[model samples]
Target: MIITKYRFLILSIMILFSVKGQSQDKFKGYFEPAIDLSYQVNPKYGLSFGVENRNVIYSDKNMQYTVKQIDLSHFSEYQWHSKYAFGLGVQYRIEHAFDVDEESELRFQEQIVYTPERSGFETDHRVRIEQRLYASVTKHRFRYQLGYTIPLAQKQANEPYLKFDTESLLEIAKTQKPELEQRLGVGLGWFVSSKTTLQFGVEYQLENYTQQLNHELFLLAELGIEL
Candidate 1:
């Protein structure tokens, strides 16, 4: 019986550790601000275009490490009925985020030599993504969206290459590392009148490496007129 109990305890401990090791797939609550413009061509069918910007600040007490995004999203709306709508859109994004800290890793040429001093290590630090999202909106302002962000550009804090295309290498790394820099969002909005509305919402970034952070807080109120 003692041996059986010991085995059970061991199994339980292993299971607990396994669960802890798994990544949490949820975003912490925060504030996100966004704005857009829409032009209504007719009642049933209309088209609109706008830009969305996100600024992400890490909740962790690290001043030097925060992620920010300046994204432009173009959107079109097709009203299927009174309670539903479908939106097709794509986003062009220019983003900047914190990389591995100054001395987290070491030199490419020699182990002990500081990478910065030796100038050998390829510290892939800065990254950029171009993403496309498809959204379906419900009448009460519930949106479910799926998107994929492809890496179009990247740069290290201090590194140079020779005999290779630097831009191409960055693009290649994007695929090799295999990141799904994706987002999922939910929110509520209020309609004040025919020409103006206010919306407030939250978004999440699901990344492969690093602990999943709440990332972006989007709060937006807009004024628009049907055109």
Candidate 2:
């Protein structure tokens, strides 16, 4: 039990030291906007699609903005229980680069989610696995997210909520070394109507790379429509 309890902490401290030894720190900020749409065919099955665009700015001595990435994705979900669902998804992504070739990726994903009842506060958990295909490499990733939402108003349609979430990821590939990333976010979401929602948030990310660690802050907004 002691070993299990301290295993992650030990790993984190080691990684921190490793990252600190490499280079000086850098800070960056980003703005991301996304839209999603879903169709519910029945109580058990649904389909969703989404697009995302990301812009990053160097906030330090050099203040320049760049188009970072764009993504297009489609997914299908099956409800296994009243509060649980599974999904399969596919995505195409484009990443911009000035020095190297522009990178593109195809990703296939599977995910499961558990969400209990909704009242004053609701909590949810999600686990995901992905197979990522790049031009010269194939990678696999695992991610998990835990989130909570609290209703600002009574239990009614078209109400607003406050959301908080944290996520962690592990990536493995043959061409590149394994890496880990973590993110935390807070947001506000409103169900504008029976079939639509709007959300805006801020997120902080820490990513580990072969050479250095990356830290970023982002402002994000999303729109979801259900048909």
The local distance difference test score of each candidate is: 0.36, 0.83
Using all chains and alpha carbons, the TM-scores for the candidates as numbered come to 0.40, 0.83
Q: Candidate 2: what lDDT?
A: 0.83
- Model 1 spans with C-alpha error above 4 angstroms: 1-31, 63-67, 79-87, 96-186, 204-227
Candidate 2 lDDT tens digits, 1-227: 43353356446545654664574776678999999999999989999999998887766646678788889999999998999999999999878453256668899999999998875578889999999998888999999998877677757777998877778999999876889988777788999998889999987777874456777778899999998
Positional deviation of residue 24's Cα in model 1 after best superposition, in angstroms: 9.1
Where model 2 places Cα greater than 4 Å from the true spot, the runs are 1-24, 96-100, 155-158, 209-211
Each candidate's number of clashing pairs is 6, 0
C-alpha lDDT (0 to 100) for residue 8 of candidate 1: 47
Q: For candidate 1, lDDT tens digit of each residue in 120-190?
A: 22222112222322122111111223211112122532221211001111111322433333343333344
Residue 177 in model 2: shift from native, Å? 2.2
Q: Please give the distance, in angstroms, between residue 166's alpha carbon in candidate 1 and its true position after superposition.
A: 39
